[model samples]
Target: MSITERLSRGFVIFDGGLGTMLHSRGLSAGVLPETWNITHPEIVTEVHREYVRSGAEVVSANTFGANRLKYGAKAGEFCLENIIRAGICCAKAAVGDTGALVALDVGPLGKVVGWPGGVGFEEAVGYFSETIRIGAEAGADFVLVETMNDIYELKAAVLAAKEACDLPVVATVVFDASGRMMSGSNPAAVVALLEGLGVAALGMNCSLGPEQMKNILPEMQKYASVPVVVQPNAGMPHLEDRKTVYDVSPAEYATHMREMARAGARGLGGCCGTTPEYIRKLVGALEGITPRPITEKKLTMISSATHALVIGEQPLLVGERINPTGKKWIKEALLAGEYSEIAEEGALQADAGADILDVNAGLPGIDEAEALKTIITELQMITKLPLQIDTSDPAAMEAALRVCCGVPLINSVSGKTESLSAILPLAKKYGGVLVGLTLDDDGIPTDVAGRLRVAEKIISEAQKHGIDPKNIVIDPLAMSVCADPDAALTTLKTVATLSASGKRTLLGISNVSFGLPMRDSLNASFFTMALFAGLSVAIVNPNSAELQKAYRAYLALSGLDENFSEYIDFAARRAAGGEAAS
Candidate 1:
């Protein structure tokens, strides 16, 4: 089955904490060679059977720390082939004809690559390729690259695994307490980098406790286009009797599993300190729950405060504040024919991180079309982030769109006949991104499905006008949360449905938190959640530090942070500049 199909069925349960299980069977912390799987087949088989009996759908082989480097120079002498083969055979025996998956577990190379330790990317790839070859040859179903921190290192491992065999690969990175990789890689950069590398699934494992994972889940789900797996610790390890103890009971741990399911996680498993009972409880808790489907919505790239809406990637934020729609000063400037102020505002937003700037000169006292032309010209001289021509007047939109440099985005076309008739043609003519609102000539639809129908109609009309589906961005129209508790969810559901259609989705995120207390919290949470529903762009107030932080966090968790170097740089700068006050 496809990854989405697997997720939709129910949460896939991976077996719990292997190291702890090994220790429980009288293996000391630094003793008992794990490579003994070749010499002591019966013990390994018994452990695999225990996990199977405890209800694990997948049990990892006992070959985690068995890499050649870890097993020392005697690795060849001890027979690496025999060790790996025996482990897989043992796991297969435990699984029987029930057909549970077996993953060839690959851990880090222990030494850092490049400047820090001199291990080059090719060398690392070669090392991991060896493991992949061994695992595949031993009949492993998939390769699990877990607990990785460096993006380059992870990339090496992924490349090696894919090159070695036809088996699927799942790559996971471990985050530090600060929600970034040890090297400062965040989840967003991780997802972006790994997804581009073609991993079957990407996720976090062996990080902080469930509560911490819960806080980061919204961010994780937002940027992930593939299945997301999370295997958090039972809780932070505590020193007890000279060994680590996790205070969370199996029941308590299962509570977090349910939360993960609700947060859109498709794969659930436990890390350090968990046992088979934990997996059993997790399975029980997630029994009837279904993973959320990707939304099938259309979105248009527009001017936004941060980045330009990338249909399949980052959401382009088009800053709406630069327009003279309702502001008296803006209107006065337009009537007075002052272009510098418009240029200055556009420049400021671009510098502040706007991916695109929305230009509107629709003042009651001015010639809208003429003013729009002048504003667009001036702004073009100051920035290159792209522009979204914003005007209800079709003539003005056409005029500005013609002069705007780069791939311009028409602010909108909609379900309304006039809008569809007018803006759709301009979007098609200019070959630019188109925004579709889920509303008709009558008014906004209150129900999600109605809004979705309107969105579909708008998409059909845009396609009829010769616009590509990828260029269309669908806005579900966020409503006030206080006005109706269900309003936000309704918009989210619409976005989710739109996403599944393989079209881009956008949302004016700040609208959802209107009139609500702690609006930032509400807005940030909603923005993150919308991303999970496949929202590709957000029209948000980029000036808010809280919002920016949340966006950065989301980007990092999504694995878009590259090697996490950006997040690390940001953190280091924050600390050096006293932005992070202790």
Candidate 2:
């Protein structure tokens, strides 16, 4: 059966290490193993046949390092098209009449992903798009973008596959012994980003063994709504005879694979130091166990490249100072292109316990798109806090989303026709926690029911574009009470109504106290009221002393502070003239 056909049935086993087998046959170290596809097609075919005979249902071709970067068409005798075509042909010949599937193994482009001095986002996308396009033309059933060490590179590859061809793209990243990517993505973070990018399955491979990889399985399972793919090394590597070797035996490795399968792995395989025997042992070991049904976590989440922040974990604080809405310094900084000022503001908010940073660079007579991109990139350099891409322009929103290192927050989409038309596609294409303001072309709703209807309309509209409603955080916007005596009551009622219906809610605390004296005191009470009403996120000035004190107090009183640690830490910071004192 095809891999997709078997996905619903049980675990679909993948072939073990190809480089290991190639080296055993005297393909020397550091000489591109991919060239062996054209040079010694028979050797490549034999290795694939061995895996198929050993019961591997899906065999990745020998095209792991076959990108245009390493083998550019210019001076190379080995072109990417020729190499990948030959590689897939070998795997295809082995799978003939065997009911197995072939996957073109697309590895990293050998550069930093989405970094300043590294490969740019579109350039990386172009490279992977060309390779995946060629792979689909060459008759591969799926694209396996494997051994990723950076989340941005993984996003680039998966986005390329989606834009390039219709093939199912599966991705796996390399996690260090600490259960984080070299770029610092934890398992939860990886799950959030890949699921956002819409990969068929996401996983870990290459760096650690089945035992070490096993320790991270629960975290992946906790957040993963799709199949969790794992291809751990046979064991940890050690130097022997001046060469690297793995320590675990095939039987020992299979034992661990079986344990991982039971714990929520829907796809299992081996990385380095495994031959066909490992697959054979693994296949036999997984005979009677049923695969766990993939869970629908429905979490409202966003992430940096390093960590995931789930909403409803004691109301997230999104720092509101990065935007140029009312901040003259930010406006000046954006116009002057002073990234240092932006970074400093981001750092300060982070120090004051902001869970996410709201980034906006929209100003007249400037390219909002370009400024948003620049500010988002610069802020990430200073902190790993997930960013909220705040802009009224659709172009600015897209530009910021394109370069964001991890899953971010799309600051808004309201009930208006134009807003929904432009923004939902971005949110759907680039995964994020979308904030939907409860307003439309009819303007701000005066009644709680009208606002609730708008939120429902947004949830419905976002769903039409295939956005999970859980990913939509409803903002029953806080209007000034000076304008309407019952405005705060309407917003609070809408927040509580949405919260009761299992919808995540957000509120801008400052909006309620606008045009009022002692606004900080009023904002703190509003914030506490929103918390009691089950707010999920608050866009506020994290540097405000009264607001900080109120938030810490709420957490401590509600038992969300875990033995009052967050509260005690806030008190300690206040004593030290920190944010609470400022």
Candidate 3:
């Protein structure tokens, strides 16, 4: 069956663990199971046939670790291409005419990508490319990337699948018992990142039992608009007679699987400690049970590797002190190639209640792309706040997007044809939360209606490029009130209009106060007006005490700050002569 059909049908069931069954057949530990596809094709075929007979609609091939990184032809006895080709052959032979689909199973390269001197992104892509290409040619139905512990390496594998073939790509990351990846990606962040990248399905698998998986599925369901695949382990593994065995029996495992299906696990399967009996029991238990409906969440979110920042949940603050604009210290740091100074700015904003950091490396006469890469890498090292990569240069923007550790905000795509053409593809490829400035080639509008027209155009172009409206944040283009007396009013009107239609609105609030005396005073007041007018995100200096007080008060009044804690903390800091922003 095609992947499109598999995803469309609610409650599609997949096969259980092959490694568990293989080990029971005396497959030695420390011996790669992928080699069995060639050396003992009969045993592998029978194992797949048992799962297919037990009602598995989709079976992943025995090629999870068959990539060159683990089984290079020069380093191992088996050739990588030969092993992958044989793996597909074994699964296809098992299915025969049973109408079961074969998925090319892919896994991580066993190394993290975003460490200081770890494997690079492109290098990880190269490792997955050859194996995936061979699998596609050998007639695998789709690519199933599972057991991913790091979000960066997971992204690399998906990019390879998209580039290698037209097969559908489904990804599943392993969350610990705490419901976070080893790299600190939580369920919401994983769902936000994968759904934005257009995965056929995405969810949790491995490193956790069914009970542990149940703890994190609610958060995944809240943000995911696509199918959620759940492949929990049978239970925690333990040593039984020096062999690994799971605690939960097949019957008990089915009970948890049934609950997961009702909780929105449309694609159900088994991981590490499960077997064909587990799949058989799960299928039988879920019989006649209607699957949970998948709904469009319409959440506007961006993330770092650690935290997912949801817009409209609270007053979203994009820290604006990292740019070289009007900041002499930043300009000096950029010119002197002192990246530590740039990183320090992001750290300070993060400590001062900034939800995201706005990174700009657009200094004149420098290689903006290289400067942006350096700035992005350093900022990611210093803080977990998602970055807003602010650059007009397309090359610099792409460079920054490539290096960002998680979901970043791209600043920005405009209504101009030139801007959309260059940026939409990058956003689509890298899956960043895109900021769309509502200004066309005709320039900033003089009135609210004109700017609204530009906003509509930006959304239209973004959808045409396959970007969801949820991923597009509309910036109403805050103009200086000194240039036009009604500029702030016009921007406010546009924000109110867009927010009413459920569009996320962002504003560079400092621009509204430009050319005015006592800028911070005007900025704080104007920011309050914009917040009341439904502004979702604001680019501002987070260290300003006036702005902090305004935001804290707003949160308390709006019921976002639980029990007035944030406002109380801010007041206590000021009363004690402590820096409110610090």
Question: Which one wins on TM-score?
Answer: 2
- Per-residue lDDT of model 2, residues 523-546, tens digit only: 999999999999999999998989
**Residue range 276-367, candidate 1, lDDT tens digits:** 88888988898777777544233333321112334566645666666665467887788789988978888878765666677778778678
Model 3, span 305-367: residue lDDT tens:
777988887779999999998888888888999988889989999998899999998888688
Candidate 3 deviant stretches above 4 angstroms: 73-77, 578-582
* Candidate ordering by TM-score (highest first): 2, 3, 1
* Candidate 2 lDDT for residue 99: 84
| Candidate with more favorable, higher TM-score: 2 or 3 | 2
Please state the error at residue 346 of candidate 2 in Å: 0.6
TM-scores of the candidates are: 0.54, 0.97, 0.96
Model 3: residue 37 alpha-carbon error in angstroms: 1.7
The alpha-carbon deviation from the true structure for residue 289 of candidate 3, after best TM-score superposition, in angstroms, is 0.5
- lDDT of the candidates, in the order given: 0.74, 0.89, 0.88
